[model samples]
Target: MPHLPDSVHVMTDDTRPHTATPTTEGVWSVRGTRITADRTPEGLRLRARAGAEGLSRIVLRWRLDTPEDARILGDAWERGYGDLQWRTLQPDRALPWYALITGGAFGGPTTGWGVRTRPGALCSWTVDESGIALWADVRSGSLPVLPGEREVDVATVVTAAGPTPFAAHEALCTAMSPDPLPAVGPLVGCNNWYYAYGRDFGPDAVLRDARTVVEYADGHPVRPYCVIDDGWTEGGGSAPGGPWDTGLPGVFDDMADLAARIAETGARPGLWFRPLLSRTETAAVRPGLLRDSGFPLDPSLDVALETVAEDVTRFRNWGYGLIKHDFSTYDVFGRFASHSPAELALPGWSLSDRSRTSAEILVRLYGTIAEAAGDAVVIGCNTVGHLSAGLVRVQRCGDDTSGRSWERTRRMGVNTLAFRLAQHDRFFTLDADCVPCTPRTDWRLNRRFLDLVARSGTALFVSVDPAARTDRTDADLAAAVRLALDGGTPGGVEPLDRLSTTAPRRWRSGAETLVHDWAEPWGAVPLAV
Candidate 1:
């Protein structure tokens, strides 16, 4: 885990300055580091600087005429895009990857990579990758380097040459950013933290899992949603820095009567929180607004953005239609899974709000928890995929999926739905998590991960443990939640044995392609790092 010297890696830092000139179309430069390259309409416009300031990172190297068994896709430098690591370009090996705005380097948020060819064209880019021979990333780290060189608008690197991989991940998610309102339709749900992982539940086990998601949506018409995850408030002896307001006296004694008893079981409640932690022994935390993980808080401080927008306006005045929230880029960069936004050098630390830039204080703390999540439906979880892309509509992306392992739900839900299923609804609605259907896992591999997350149209949560209900059967999780809320199928997965497995057991959805042994009914399990 030492890795960093590829000339000071974190995606090529080399202590700034690599001089490049000759502008007009695509190259400009300065000394302490300043570079640019324009040619827009949505392709090349790479800028950088250090002279008038703004130069924390810039690493560019592109050469094409590609094709050598190309196959790479990226999205998820956080949460759990379940062991995502696909490759092909090894006549000596060189397949690097990168793409970050906040949570850079290793703590996740390397959101970029894609190069496919097998006739069905594709091209996507963003952060980190060292194969296909080096495209180091960091593009911009920590933040606030500005004074001159601009163009690092979310670390510029937008390429979208489509034909397939779902129109090049929906044109690299609409050239990476500005395209939120798709109203994220498709979230067949139920999420008691993979069978109560925060150790048990409440509010009558979260309204008996909202009457088990209204008896697994027996009123189908896409309603579902129960959520509640991360045990309902009050210190359960320290979790996500503990102590969130209201509910939990004797387990959610009344978070608005458990959202009016899960809206009298017609389902649709969701809650979760974690807004940047608190639990310094259950509340009143303010040791000069803690961070560096000592009870997390500091959302670049404004009393932690007025107490996380008054706990997301008291979970949208307690009528919740979904809030989720979770971890805030590991509680605002305290670091996550492996660490890398330049080894957490939060732009040479010295905060308490030095006037923005940790990607504008995480897009103003994810736009103050998406403006107190009014009208609910926020999601995010573990957060930050290019500043939670238009402030989240649902984007867990990957990492947790094992109500007790079918080899950790086929290495985090079939490798994050076969490699970030083209940012499922183009960025936000791609929740690649859940489908635990336990009994200690293995309903012939969780029914092929509930028939590939109900035909992989994305976001298909389902946790269910009830002590593995006598070896599963809520009518087979109500026909996999009625094929993930009404037979989903707008396909495009393809993998077909990724250059030899980082959990690619052959795939191809749109036109039918199959093969699975994800280590057969549970056998191997090693690849966690």
Candidate 2:
């Protein structure tokens, strides 16, 4: 264990010098990361910075001691992701580097920061030191054993070189600096291809026909963000052979006309793009981007990404208000052999080097999109969560559930609920998997799912084609939208049955609201408001 120094934890006796290995259960040591922790008989509560921290720069914040102890616990090792960046914290200003209630530890049924497979008991932390400026209290007997609440503790670790705790705390404190920009009400937007890219069959006739949804959205109480999916790559024309060039002429011209119409409907125009993806299906994909075959093409390279900066600018100026950048993770992993199981897969590139490069690619792509679009709202897709963290304001809280909207909605609903509950504080909004809840089966069930998702955090997206659904269903849809507009608490799932991943007993979606039982996957038990 090497002496790590970054404030990455909170509460309790400081353990700054404790070092951590990049491997899941390796030793963790740090400087003065504030661990805002809650304790239980099992372990301490921990929450890592969602957008803020990757494993690269995190170290447990503890009061430093003799170099003798540090040398004994420290090895000159640098594990994966990012290389080490260290700075000694003058014993006065504790290693507080973030504004998040970082990570923690706990026993059964709690989020795992670390655990041992062999012992099966919460690993006892080796206390290196305790000195000036400690805020944790001593547990006389034991921490209160609350029924529903997991006995967890919190810690704020310095997960990275940028965004210090004081910096974040100050930003949050000063967030309300007088009258700000227009409160961009969460727009009810829909990017057409989510139900299945219309591009597969060569721009289905229906994609061109989706104008009606945009036309209808214009009449809603709030302005909507409607996006034209993949087919209309309006201005990539400069790259004549680029995918954007082949689209129908006057696409933007017609869309500009539609924009005026949408303006009347009080809707904003947004466009969908598989930013990192240029299908051979579409010509935008440069030959170098695709695998000589397909599916397993590498996604970490610049060539694979088609990042034509000017093209993005054209879209922004073209009057598109929001941009959905999709599919950076074209391959799940660069597994060497086909059908390689978990046992066979190797880390793509150098595990040490590639992960950081993967992270770099993410920031660049997102930063590029953000810069290119100015203030246009950006939503990242298929970008494994950690990569898109804080850089993106809104994210697909759940996976993209397109053609199989129902099943995708259900699974994505569960995933986004838990993920958002875990990361709600990271960003302002959660793109709950899009819902097309109708009067059909599980309609009310689906309605409840959407309401729960939005109530917790700002939710953006809509799949109902009001013109298509019945009048009554439309009323319900509107009410759901209204509640979403109003907002509600985020959700968390507490396991009732003994530790099992199959499902949790009491699944709660809000702060102190209601909890539903998903014991048997599809059991829909009703709850009253």
Candidate 3:
């Protein structure tokens, strides 16, 4: 039997309800707005048409049939968002994109509900004893949609019942993202961000890092990557905004030369840039192309998009094989997923073009980047996974891990890796951020993380600070890099204790069940910096 929603609700402006009249079996209308729910083999497809009054949200309610004591697991908004674990039902907690229910009446099988990420609206779910409510936020920023009567793709809802929660979640992910971009070989690399933090790094420092990663690879057939993260562009140092057209005047005189030097050391050269941000006040970057009187370039503007495309093309022309674009979600919406509310973006500020939703604008921006990147592997940092699935080859699934603090890594890195691991390859090559081997962090814990990431067969990146490298650390990193280049372990990895803990301690690989202690002698500290 097909599982259909019991009722449909529409909201405009705030939470003020608009009457939705059922027109047909799977269709509803509100004022001039129309919503269609089409049943598919895997699940249901939801699309909506906005009326002149504009549309804010389209909610579908499904009656709950499972036991009350079932455990539920939910996903995050984008990379760098965490706090994911299986827990008792929280009626008002927003589960972004998907939610999974297990235990209770369903002994072994798990029931999963997920909305496809590739939609014009941000999708979330709220579950209570009576039922489940899937909320499609179609608002243009905080305001109601004024896009006229044009049809907008809301979201696709997929449900699965499999033997285990992992299996069920995997099935739902596969159904949600049908066409993910293929990864370019083994994605083992060294990123300098955690250690360097986009400061005091010149061409020589970058080449030293490249040589370190290549040395670690030890002549593996698959070349490792050396990404020169941040700091390479004009107005150098840890400043967030950019004028990405040229290298820093004295530090990085020629980016093309730097790329060639990195490639000469037998490592693939990668570059990082903040495309939607610019410090350069030029005629091309007009006030109309900005959301506020600030640095963030409004992606809704054609001029801003042209600027991004030109920057990407320039990077590709520099002979960089991989391009890691960061902070688009933040630049677009003015906040990170962790800081924003369940609505994803703060209210009170709409885009320059109010006709399109935030999701639609982001999709356009990602498509623009992908097109300009051409043959280069695109790694989206701080980009929405659903919108970038088919466009980017890799998605940073978690928030930044720390070189300064271990608790931050345990909180953000471990939690996201254990929970979002199901989305690996199904959406894009999941990057749980880099494992930082620095003086401030413990090598023992970092080594364990390195082993797991390499074995998982996802993107494995390490930030190896020169001061932190010892004989033991060098041996461990070399082994992990070689293993990752060979495509991790054959059977892949699975988190065994994901339901009980945010940072799972137990994981299964092939026939072996491995366990590691993430805690220090003093236990977990507050996640600071």
Candidate 4:
């Protein structure tokens, strides 16, 4: 198939400014009548520049709109930890990662939440008439983020300040599930903590005795096996030298204990992992077992996967059920600068191809893992949906993004939901990852937002720390799961009126006082409200 021509490359002309202001910082690169604006939206965006054939990104990150409450973000950026560095455009001019909030970035109103890290990458938390907020992210090598260059960030002169995290005047295209959730079967299960989600992070506060995690799943209508996330092997958390603690040595046995626990709960236990992102340099990787594919070494593909099969066979020997396999896309698509001390290796023949290769490597890795995990309920996160279609039975379609901010609901969650609806029920179940996984601090409003994303009736499972119990109510969490496993909400997602110039639009769950703008396709502008 012929790739689209450069004529299709479109850059919004208005983002350009007639004059430079010291307060303004960003760059404009002109390529054959095409001008690319690489501006920091309050040091808010982590984007990439394409060498003509890659994906160009404009990451307008969605974060809590408050400063103090923004502690969640600090966890990802970790300022006091002193700059977290990594290799980006490695082996040449290395880039260092940093978290910066240009202030007033989160000036918009209530919206959704989430986080991630990278050097030269930035996060902003600020307010105007809208609300309190914070957001940070780094561009992957897939796109070259030309540092020390001029870029433009669009600044709309608003008569009235807004507090929503939604881009100004952005159109939304939402697809309500054609299938009714009201007809699905009852459910019982465990929250899918990825393979990497093991006893990491200073001990498993919740699933300490793998057996305890299983015990909790006993009576739930929706039965999920225990699934652990990253940090299973060697070391993790804030680079290598940092305080790395999570997961025990034995990968298989840990899974075994956890699986046995799931059996006790009358549920299934699943495993989580960013299988494609691993280095053979670590002692964790079994030597000689992994083939030198010359591609970035994915330890899971090399050693971890075999361990799971052996473990599952042990389960088979003892009569254990299926597994939940998970993958995180972020690691596969990181923005590490090569010069950074914390830089991980990205096997490469040439410098420029790093970003593109990581993506290709993931494509290969998914198929490889699926083949290895026979019948396991695999879920993907930070994932590219179409790639995992049919590969994993379930895909974490949105960010595990959770927060109390009302605006959060509209941010990353719905954006991902709307853009990828076609794949909702395509090859596997679409998992709007961890909605009710949130504790029931604020009942009604919380459930509403989650319920809306559970659209298409393909809602897979709900996640919460087994220790994620709430002071508020299981009343809300249980209701959502029941609706999900026992089918879904009575009426299904009740979308609000057309609020933007975007096609297939949606207004999932608005705080009762739902006041908003609809996305209008062929709309006036990108974020022009």
Candidate order by TM-score, decreasing, is 3, 2, 4, 1
In the range 116-224, model 4's lDDT, one tens digit per residue, is: 1111223232232323222211222323332223332211111112232222111110111122112123323444332223335423432542343334433555554
Stretches off by above 4 angstroms in model 4 are 1-222, 231-253, 279-329, 336-361, 403-410, 436-444, 453-456, 460-472, 489-529
Q: Compared with the true structure, what per-residue lDDT tens digits does model 2 show for residues 217-318? A: 435565556666555653331111233323456444354455455444455676666554333443333233344233222333454344445556666766
Prediction 4 global C-alpha lDDT: 0.35
- Candidate with better lDDT, 2 vs 3: 3
lDDT values, one for every candidate: 0.58, 0.38, 0.84, 0.35
Return the top candidate by lDDT: 3
lDDT of 2 at 41: 33
* Model 4: residue 315 alpha-carbon error in angstroms: 9.5
Candidate 2's C-alpha runs over 4 A off are 1-156, 159-185, 194-222, 231-242, 245-260, 279-306, 331-356, 402-405, 438-441, 465-468, 488-512, 515-529
Greater TM-score among 2 and 4 belongs to: 2
Considering lDDT, where higher is better, how would the candidates rank from best to worst?
A: 3, 1, 2, 4
Error of 3 at 292 (Å): 12
- CA error at residue 443 for candidate 2, angstroms: 1.7
RMSD (Å) of each candidate, 1 decimal: 17.1, 15.2, 2.1, 15.1
Query: Model 3, stretches more than 4 Å misplaced?
Result: 104-108, 282-294
Model 2 has an lDDT value of 0.38
- TM-score, each model? 0.36, 0.54, 0.96, 0.47
Pick out the ten consecutive residues of candidate 4 with the lowest summed lDDT: 72-81
Candidate 3 accuracy as TM-score: 0.96
